[model samples]
Target: TLNKKLIEKSEELKQLSNDLSSANENLIIKDRQKDDFLDSVAHELRTPITAIRSAGEILADDDDIPLDIKREFLNNIITESDRLSEIINDILYLDKLQHGEIALNIHENNIIETYKKALSPILHLIQQKNIHISEVDLLNQYIFEYDEARMIQLFHNILGNALKFTDEQGTIQTKLSEKNDFLIIKVFNTGKNIPEEDLEMIFDKFYQSKNQNIIKPIGSGLGLAISKRLVEAHSGNIKAENSGLGVTFTITLPKKIINNNEVEQ
Candidate 1:
């Protein structure tokens, strides 16, 4: 009689365990569905935005329109389109990165060359803001093996962040140096110091410093998170530090010097 009772209890416990497992699985599925919904919404909105921006540009090209008004309208349309495109690309790239499919095409590229290439598009803004840029004993000839596109994106994010946060006429400096066996890239910006508590989570997905006043515009808060992923993909490291009464981000990439001159220098 006791044996039969023990068997019945074991069966009941097993059924309960299975039910709990099923519940947990359902919750995971629901969470994934929510993420999917958000991604779909972003994609749908991007289509209409692209179409509208293109139409606006076409209209602006009409010679009948006043040149000044046409120019202003054209600029507004392009700016809005670029912003939307940036958001959509970030989301889609992040989604692929999560799925382990973002390809890295690493090559031996010159650091200064890469920096200059990435800065070309934003020179106007830097000039308008009166942000001063300098390097720290940086040699223009250092080369490191890395994914050019990904590193460019990383540079754009870090420098772009500085541009957004720093006030007009603030000084921003970038430095590249070789330390131990790694190549270090540092971007320093004078801005509101990030709270100590928030610093720990600044690289977390959807994490943004609450101390950053809504100046100009803010990104979707995924830039740092995506930057971290790209750095790690190259077996590199990245971190933030408070310096010069401001904020600085330090990135270290593992050095695979492709030239004899690299180690000699």
Candidate 2:
């Protein structure tokens, strides 16, 4: 009996030690991720700042510069300044969100209306490209519980991205349905297929794909990251995959979210 007791105690202690080591490793990984995030932010900010400073210096140093050329430089400064502001704002917002400084107000509402509102900001751009937009017709309403504003933000990020990457005259579609006790929303776009390896990492902060079909680099590369966080805040899931001719983003949200201020998955 004494020998059995000793063996049991030793086993428990070994398990406890292993658990502590695993937890310590997680902390180290998190710290490393924080360092990487800061480095990426600085790297992204540098481009616009450099462009703005160079354009300003040229405009100031060259007095005989033609009025038209000066106007062009001024435009460049304005554009780069806007870009810098966007990067800073996204970083601040994401940091607060990840740290739980902000709360989500989850409630019941007409999800379809929220979806339409998400499209309003980018509708003109879609029209400009002559892209076809469609929604899967639902016989009954999808009155699901979610943070209305956050859902709009989530959809805007995915839809706007599809618009940005899709070819002119391409097609964009959205479908909403219920699976088990969850609501599933999918956004599909016609564009170049994303590399298979990048499907999952696209949600990581500051991650950019090795292959980009567009001539100019897309937005701060933070849109999908924000989308992922927003979905998770509602106890939801979001993922992307390369489809037949393009990529599709699928978001799954619980139909019933029990929330005080924050949700847990």
Candidate 3:
């Protein structure tokens, strides 16, 4: 009986040892993957940086550059630099969030006001696309206490997506409504539809839809994942669904009335 017990114990110990070994291997693999991602980010950032740097150097040396040419060159430099900075900062911010180092500056904000403010910069894109925004509830004032900047970032990410996918002159609609103590905002776009199989993995980090690859946009494919994290940080929810035309992204934010102890009632 003692011999049989010893055999059983030895088998259990071996199994436990194997499990630990497997876990350690997985950790090593994950570390390698992270390193690869960082390398890819660095490589991607360099392209825009190179363009901006070359333009700046030329502008610095060429005193005889035509005024119009100089202006165009300067604009390209600014645009490329801005694009590079955004991509670098986004990756760094995502890493910070993942490592629990991101801090939020929470404040009271009106959702509609915030939306309006954030959308101002992209008005040109909206107009150029001729995407008509159909409003559902403009009268509903959604005031919530949260990280204002992150909320803006989340909205920008989704709206940027709508702009990217929607075809020319397609309609994109924004709806804000209240439901059971939550303020919900939905952005619906008319364009290529997401495949059923792709929907499940769309929110995964670095997971761009196969359709997206066919029409690749200038993004790291981390926008939706980062937006999702930002929303969850505010105790909110975000989801994407096929809009019968293109795609619809819905964001639910838990809100409270200003200077009141009671939640939205």
- Candidate models: Cα lDDT each: 0.76, 0.87, 0.78
Sort every candidate by TM-score, greatest first.
Answer: 2, 3, 1
Per-residue lDDT of 87 in model 3: 80
Per-residue lDDT for 218 in model 2?
Answer: 50
- CA RMSD (A), model 3: 5.1
Q: For every model in order, what is the number of clashing pairs?
A: 0, 0, 0
Reference-based TM-score, model 3? 0.77
* Cα-based lDDT at residue 152, candidate 1: 85
How close is every model to the real structure, measured as TM-score? Answer: 0.68, 0.91, 0.77
The reply for model 3, stretches above 4 Å from the true place, is 1-4, 7-11, 53-67, 107-109, 179-181, 195-214, 219-222, 255-265
**How much is 201 displaced in model 1, in angstroms?**
2.3
Which prediction has the highest lDDT against the true structure? Answer: 2
lDDT of 3 by residue, 113-143 (tens): 8887778788799899888877778677777
Residue 132 in model 2: shift from native, Å?
A: 1.6
Whichever of 1 and 3 has more lDDT, that candidate is 3
lDDT digits (tens) for residues 1-265 of candidate 1: 9999999999999999999999999999989867865765565556658766676867756768777877777776776677667667877877776666776776888888888888888879999999888778566588778778888888988888888888888978998888887988899998877777777777765554566553434455578878887777777779998886689999998876332221110
- Tens digit per residue, CA lDDT, model 2, 1-265: 9999999999999999999999999999999998999899989999999999999999889899999999999999999999899888888888777877767887888888899899998999999999999889644589988889988999899998899888999999999998899998989999888888878888898887777553335567688888888888888889998889888999998988755566333
Report the poorest 10 consecutive residues by lDDT, candidate 3: 256-265
